[model samples]
Target chain A: MKKDRHFYWRLFSSTFTLSAFTFGGGYVIVPLMQKRFVKELKWIEEDEMLDLVAIGQSAPGPIAINTSILVGYRMAGIPGALLTVTGTVLPPLIVITIISYFYIAFRDNHLVKALFKGMQAGVAAVIVDVVIEMAARIIRNRRLLAIIVMALSFIAAVLLKINIVIILLFCGILGAYTTLRSKHDARSSPDSGKDESCAEGSGTGGSAGKKEGSD
Target chain B: MIYLQLFWSFFLVGLFSFGGGYASLPLIQEQVLKINSWLTPAEFMDILTISQMTPGPIAINASTFVGTKVAGLPGAVIATAGCVTPSCIIVLTLAVLYYRFKGLDMVQGIIKGLRPAVVALIASAGYSILLTVLFDSDDYTFRLSDLDFIAAGLFAVSLFLLRKFKLNPIYAMLAAGIVGMVIYGFLPSF
Candidate 1:
């Protein structure tokens, strides 16, 4: 029981410190989490960490929180999940709370306004980089369907001004339909397994490979 | 009632915030700025800036900031809870299903489909922010002469640094802020 308590405390503290220190976003926390959990602590294997990250990325919500939940659950089930999330969220909640108290004074400051104005441009630039990088990966895969979907969705959102929720739902249903149809086709063929693996590889393998290369 | 509204708004943000932090911008923008008018575009941009500079996830930070602005400490707690609730529920359920099924093809396909759309959402969000930064207007009707050349220049340089040199975004933002302080803050005539 004492050992279990220690383990839980470590889990909470690890996530707490990580969440407290890391900046930039969820992606920035990935390698650190891997280093801490997979390398330092040896809590999770390397590949398991990768799979957890993949799942975290694919699911809705913040990748950092999703990842913390997965790691926590894998470590100690629901209680672990709760502890890790609280740890993960507490840092920002505290920091932002303190900042919020000073926000009114900050807002009226001329220098602060100027600073945020500049930071706004930087933020926009970073988002553009993200778009370019993501789009390039899809285009690099040479998947015609992926390319078309990318273009069409961009058009729908920018030109037609459609709600993003509608766009995501439409694409998700379309994706499932196409995948099911392709599976049906493969099932009737002689080499079904190979085809399915190939499709899966092309869909996710690109990002996974890039992540490895970066590491 | 306001607390409930804050929770529900952030809950929806938590539920549909796929792709990552940048992708969630549009959804949060729609909820806070468009629907509820809780924040102006400039304030929204500041929230994004603060989120980037702070620790933890952007969604969480943004929620806390917005919530506090809307309803103080209790509001911040409730809004943050709302943002995290979907993540906990969805991730825990997925964790169970993943261990049981190993790999689900339908989930993979849905993710595959969501990728491109996520890119689109991020791009659209960036486009709007870019407009606000450069033209000082979120609307599309700004004249060419209305463009802020200094901001445009800073954006281009920052993009170049991020892509070519792989500079950390936090540093880029800091550099931009210092530059803005010197130029816009000190020299109003230039």
Candidate 2:
């Protein structure tokens, strides 16, 4: 699908505004993204937002940038992705640079120190909220296999202190193996209405090949 | 030379920081604190607080902050670019191909499997920060005096406001900062 004449500008400006106001982190920016992309622009559906976030979370680097790239690519391909990522990253770079110039001057100030101490607590609390919100969503699926994978991953990540890349790699392989076996079994039976794989939401561009194996 | 170091340091941070910003903290600490000696542990905590108040991903905010301190505006630019380059490359490629292969059951399954792990990683990240802020040492030891009651109280109040009232965290952070000034900045005699 062809994009509008000012697609790049729209992509850049939208992401720029969103990133400029996004405090906390990825979860905080997501709802704003839904409003802008799903509601206002009609770029993608609500469920598709979740998929984009999931893809972002699974990928390396910050979820905010990853989501921008995904949404941008969906709207206008690679250039769109590049533009959005640049826009999303710009606010932090500019603001933090300004802050750093004064960091030394203020580092030893009593008021500043106290304020940061308090903010540390606040930041930690917000992180707790993020953890709870994410956990609740993941658990809602109620798939035993999924839960098991999560638990093992937790052990590997938090307990054993294994590298995150290793955990993700293993889980990716396991997911692929488990789902491939299930798909083989389902092929012999009558097709069901619920096709998890086909649940990916559509957008104006990058339709990819439609799922063709199952009727 | 320092610019290259800044670029390489943040580049690794961006590459390995999977899940989200918070989950990337340990990696950031390793690079900034352990390897580079750019910031001390206490200074790192301060910057982390600043990161939250600032508008951006924690990892990006951190890279910019450290980059500026280490070098200057150019350092900030290079570090920020380093931090984002991995995402740009990886996500752009994935976005191009994902929808094409998204129909495969395995792709869906992998996402499903990764969901819980992401939660776990996030939780662990949060828990570690919570411990550091609330307690004196991060040794997993429980001690009364070791606990910073003021910080702990602020954490409790902030968590309550965020989860129960669904308050925007920015306000809570601002409020807590004010309270911190009152308690730590002014009430030293008490």
Candidate 3:
């Protein structure tokens, strides 16, 4: 009992510290969680970590949140899961609370105003990095089909202002058709759609690795 | 009314927020800014800025900040909880059916389709941010033009430094913050 308790505490602390400082939400948390969970604590193996990334991405919610819950739950079951989520969320809750207060006060301050101007630019760059990185990943590694679908969706949402929900549903059907068409193609082996990335803005997680492992 | 708003904003965002955190923004903007008028367009824009700068999902951050804004301390807790609760329930349900539908072709296709859709959603939100926060088209007033160019350059240079140099994002953000502070001291943002 004591051993388990200590284990849970360590996980809580480690995950808490990690989540606290992780700026940029889901994608940023990837390597950080990899270091702690895969390398330092030896909690999850590398391949499993990748699999978890895929799983967590597909599951729902932010990748970090889902990952925390899975790691926490695996470590100590329900209690462990609760502890992990708490650990991960607590620091942000505290820090953001304070930041929220000061941000409210400082929103109009010249210093903050200047700071956000730069920060906003940084945020855009991060998004650009994500899009570029994914484009390279898919273009070099995946299919031309993925690019076409992405462009179509962009037109649908940006040009149309069609509620994202409707676009998602409509495009979702089209996406499935592509998946089905590719599935039985003789040249394509199994696992072609297994390594998707949710954190990097793709909602699914199986395509990249699945394709790669076939070779 | 404020308390009611806290519940409503969260409930609505939580109800519709699918795929991931950024996916929540459009729904949130509609509820908090357009539908209810709880926050002005400027204040709503500020909330987004703060959300990006801080930790956690943007959805969670908005819930906490807006909740706090509308109703104070209790509002923060309640709103955050509300935002997360739906996901918890849904994910738990998802966990049960996870294996049964694991290899379904349709699911894979939906996911594939979602990528483009998700990208579009993000692009749209980014556009909305630009419209609300960056430019004033009617008068053509450059609200923060000087800082805008500097920030864009900073972001581009930092990305180069980050990928080319293999430096960490923390270092980049900190360096940018320091740069902002330096610019604060030197140039008059007035």
TM-score of each: 0.91, 0.81, 0.73
What's the CA error at residue A165 for candidate 3, in Å?
Answer: 2.1
Q: Which runs of model 3 end up more than 4 angstroms from their true locations?
A: A1-4, A34-49, A135-145, A177-215, B1-31, B34-53, B97-107, B131-189
- What lDDT does candidate 3 reach at residue B128? 55
Name the regions of candidate 2 deviating beyond 4 angstroms. A1-11, A28-58, A71-77, A136-159, A191-215, B1-5, B34-37, B98-105, B138-144, B187-190
Question: Which structure among the candidates has the greatest lDDT?
Answer: 1
TM-score of model number 2, chain B: 0.80
- Model 1 preserves the real interface contacts to a fraction of 0.77
Best-fitting candidate, scored by DockQ: 2
Give the alpha carbon lDDT tens digit for every residue of B69-187 in model 1. 99999999999999999999999998787665556678888888888888878888888888999998865446789899889999999999999998988898899888977778986
DockQ of 1: 0.59
True contacts kept of each: 0.77, 0.81, 0.42
lDDT of 2 by residue, A1-215 (tens): 44566767888999999999998776788778889998998767666677677677767788888898888876666777788888999988888887887878887887888888888888778878878887777779787877777778777756787866677667767777877887788777777445643454343222432121111
Q: C-alpha displacement of B18 in model 2, angstroms?
A: 4.1
Model 3 alpha-carbon miss at residue B78, Å: 2.3
Candidate 2 residue pairs in backbone clash:
none
